[model samples]
Target: MALPIPTTLDEITADWLTSALRQSEVISEKTTVLARTVEVLGVGEGFAAELARMHLSYKNGSGPATVIAKIPTSVEDNRNGSELLGVYERELRIYERILGEIEVSTPRLYYGDIEVNPDAASQLERIRKMERLPIWLLRLILWFLIRFNKGKTFPSVLIMEDLSPAEAGDQVQGCDLDRAGEALEAVALLHAATWGDRCPQERYWLVSSAVAPRLFHAGALGARRGFLKNFGRLLSDHTRELYESTRTDNIERTIRLHREVPQCMLHGDFRLDNMFFARDGGFRALIDWQLSSFGPAVSDIAYFICGSIDPGVSEAEIDALLARYHRALESAGVSDYPLEDLHAHYTEQLLLLLARMASVDLLDLGDQDGRGADLVSVWIERLDARMARASSGR
Candidate 1:
């Protein structure tokens, strides 16, 4: 039987959230209601039906205030087991520890929750019937149900300071050199601050011992069979050959590189989607530190460059950005690390990207039939072209 389609914010009301919040003890009945709204933001094309931001309003004794709430996407929760909540909780802890210690920007956290709301019973019932729903959709419905299920659960809500997107808005399409530079700068600061000797022992160890192993395991398992099977079904014969030629060898290379390379704290998912810019271009804030781990610095750097930059960005611009990144790292006192080593690490990072694109449903170029195929084809073409040039001693 087909499951019910996931419910939208349009299908839900502020009252639903308010009741959930009150019931979960995130808010009290005595708190004055100011305004309630659910803005569905950043619903990326993936099985992870994670909503990026949720805004809530109520009156304190002095005046009205707003808080941004985050709920885990169902796909992520299911894939990792019930420990997803623990991950978010740990993320908050790490964010708090590094807030003042690091140069990287992050929002001020208020509170977080891991409980279900008593009012979502009806919504949960509808969710149970849905079939063929995307993973993201399933997560969306599950979030509602989790919030509505009757029981006292700890930390069922988190309050955070609201950071609005830049007035100019997201520059996902155009190749803005200045913005690109700013993004790289932000990443550099993050990498520098999180490197060895600079970071706390606990933080560093978490990356090296826990996060890195989990990511490598997940990536390896998913790529070994799951990703190739799906990706092969999605590509044409010629495209498949290009992808296979560009992919399998690179995966082996990356595995070897992972064994040989020194590890550092890496933002596992460093992409444009996770970045927020200030209106005046004064600063850029990196969010979603849940996937952070100890790995090669090149991994984060490559992800940002490949995933953030527009398709039209020239090779010259890419080189310039690469130079800037190295300079930033050196200035941050990463003197012992050679530029050549960084470059090699970057190649390994690119291989990781190939593995990721093959293994996951995260990229959002467009619909699966044409746009997605075109985007994947373009990626494969770029990979093959770059590999050919390198082999030819370019």
Candidate 2:
């Protein structure tokens, strides 16, 4: 039987480590974990999950000396929110079915699992029972339950080969041109490998390729309201006008319009914080696959640039980096996608990004020592500058 999934750091024990390692075939059956020290990692850098470094001593001096263990957030609201979006299942599915098949750089997964909440299962049944009722009634009940947040939680556990000593990039600090180039290269490799593939199309449940209008519309409205309250002073007239134009329907339309372009698997949440850089100034790996999806690959490009590029980066520099990304894609054998098309799509991606600004409000930033808010503040400044330049035809 599979080991019980741990919800908190305290539940990660030596016995559990031994069973999990053996189950994943990472260690021999004879190997036993004698002791382990857990160090919580990325304390406030992540919102959906919690991570820790497990330093282990084996009875036979075999198996990995250290590994990274990931678990669902202990916060009830975040846990339930994650479950509602199926992000836990999506991450596990990507690790199991997609990552190995692609050329992208990501941490090596040792073992991954998500335990369905029995209470959630029961609640699901209750929702199912109402299916026989009128369609309107069902919709009303679901909307009400979702609005108030019902009892839903999916506890997940993922253990992976630790890639420490590699530093995580700072979103608030942004990145230099060299790091930006490396990030684009990594994204190109991913998009090129999955370009126009049927993996996501066939395994629909494994990827969130399609946009959910209801969920997005609701979130966007709230996000927009909160963003205006917190960062309205930072917006220039042009940017504020631009932000005001990204109504819920317009945002959806912008995203949906890109459907005509080639699609690929995207690290839906591509940003500096999600990437690790080697000490020698090389990209190590990308983490946080909860938002993995298939979409116009350039969307990831725009997301990365908007969040990571230094706010003062010149337009020419940004263009050069994008050109480099295009060349990398071509080098990987992607054809028929031209530089002009990439640029055009990138502009649209920026507008969609403006709509996405509100999303910052959804994050739990209470424990982030204001770093999260500061990150968003800087990110908007970058977006505002970029959008202004775009408007002036620069």
Cα RMSD to the true fold for all candidates: 10.0, 4.0
lDDT of 1 by residue, 238-264 (tens): 434544555346535555665666556
Which ranges in model 1 have alpha carbons more than 4 Å from their true place?
A: 1-33, 45-49, 52-65, 75-87, 115-157, 165-175, 199-205, 209-262, 361-394
**In candidate 2, which residue ranges exceed 4 Å CA deviation?**
117-147, 202-204, 248-252
**lDDT minimum window of 10 residues, candidate 1:** 1-10
Least accurate 10 contiguous residues by lDDT in model 2: 119-128
**Winning candidate number (TM-score):** 2
TM-score of decoy 2? 0.89
Residue 292, candidate 1: alpha-carbon lDDT? 69
The TM-scores, one per candidate, come to 0.66, 0.89
Residue 291 displacement (Å), model 1: 1.1
Error of 2 at 90 (Å): 0.6
